[model samples]
Target: MPITLHDAFVPTAQQILRAVRGLVDKAERHCAENGVADSELIEARLADDMWPLPWHVRSCWVHSGYAINRFKTGVFTPDFTDIPDDWDAMRDQIDDALTQLDAITPDTLEELAPQTVGFELGGQRLMEMTGQNFLLSFTQPNLFFSCLHIL
Candidate 1:
């Protein structure tokens, strides 16, 4: 069977988003088990100059949410500011991304798959791609990269 755009994009994004959510779970459990504060995990980075953990989490949220909205609306608006500082905020961001994915129907994805659109960030045109190519090449890689960083 041929893969639809929805199949190519939605379920993969959803799975990665769930894995990101699980990272939050593991962090909370680790903090509780070791009597460490969440800040210890939230602020830690592999290097001093690297983004802190919250930035990774925020990037995951932003990438997932941005990919969904951009594919659906053909507008590439992405923001990673206002990083979630605590568990509730992090979970909320994950839930919000999941909700956005859930709102897209298979028909919508089919309608989008053949359309060529601008991929931009901050008013800069990154490139142009058909929706199917956008999903397969652009959004999926960004989502996975952010998810790996979050994990």
Candidate 2:
């Protein structure tokens, strides 16, 4: 009875990402059922200083995607230049993230576990840690934060 690295990372992240997709579906349904434009929700924020709803959804995908990408490559770049601005595009973003995460098999997670991983921001090295810590501490928390905001 032990929790392997694959159990700790892939399935946990996949479950949260799947929930992110569900949030997208719910948003679409809510808008249609109420005859309210998706923008009405997507563009709204809990406060003026906060990022809008779409940003939250995008971050959920981006954070998880970055973990996968960075674990494989040791580098991450901010490239939301083609941001998803509509409901369909948002759902596609989540789907694309799910696809990327799905590619990380149990074997892959095992390979990554003892390796060093670095987090980069703005073309500068941010921090480096073991892959396990990076996935469990930084990546999972940020991804969950994004998901929580959707509710």
Candidate 3:
């Protein structure tokens, strides 16, 4: 089935969430590596700080679900914290968000406004939303790491 804006949003949200998961996983491994390497851990912290810093835990995906809804009411706000000290807590939420994303398809997406509508900040309205840009903002990582570290 052809993907729609809705489909794009959910998966893109999931993708962002997955990035968090990956970062958390990397952090965990780095911590477990017994100081053999600190670069990845340092990079993880830097990558995380790339987004608006969360004073507490709101900025993290564990609560923000990719920070798609900043106010938790679909509004843009300063949210998402850092990764949890115990990464295990993140599994279920990430899985659930991914599942929610899977439900998105062209059919549901068609109901959404065009790319120019702009993502909602709080009113659940698409006043200036544009699907294309929204999708990119959700999926694109401003602080992406290179393959060299993963290898």
How far off is residue 78 in model 2, in Å? 4.4
Best by lDDT: 1
Query: 1 or 3: which has the higher lDDT?
Result: 1
Candidate 2: C-alpha RMSD to true structure equals 1.6
Off by over 4 Å in 2: none
Model 2 TM-score?
A: 0.90
Worst 10 residues of 2 by lDDT: 74-83
Scored by Cα lDDT, where does model 1 land? 0.80
Q: What is the per-residue lDDT of model 2 for residues 1-151, given as tens digits with 9 covering 90 to 100?
A: 8787778766777788788778778888999999999889889888889888778878877777656776777555545556689888888888888888777777777787778887777778888888878788887888788778877
Lowest lDDT 10-mer window, candidate 1?
62-71
What is the per-residue lDDT of model 1 for residues 81-119, given as tens digits with 9 covering 90 to 100? 688889878888888989988888989889888887677
Off by over 4 Å in 1: none
| Candidates 1 and 2 compared by TM-score, better number | 2
Clashing pairs in 2: none
Candidate lDDT values, in order: 0.80, 0.78, 0.43
Which has the better lDDT: candidate 2, or candidate 3? 2
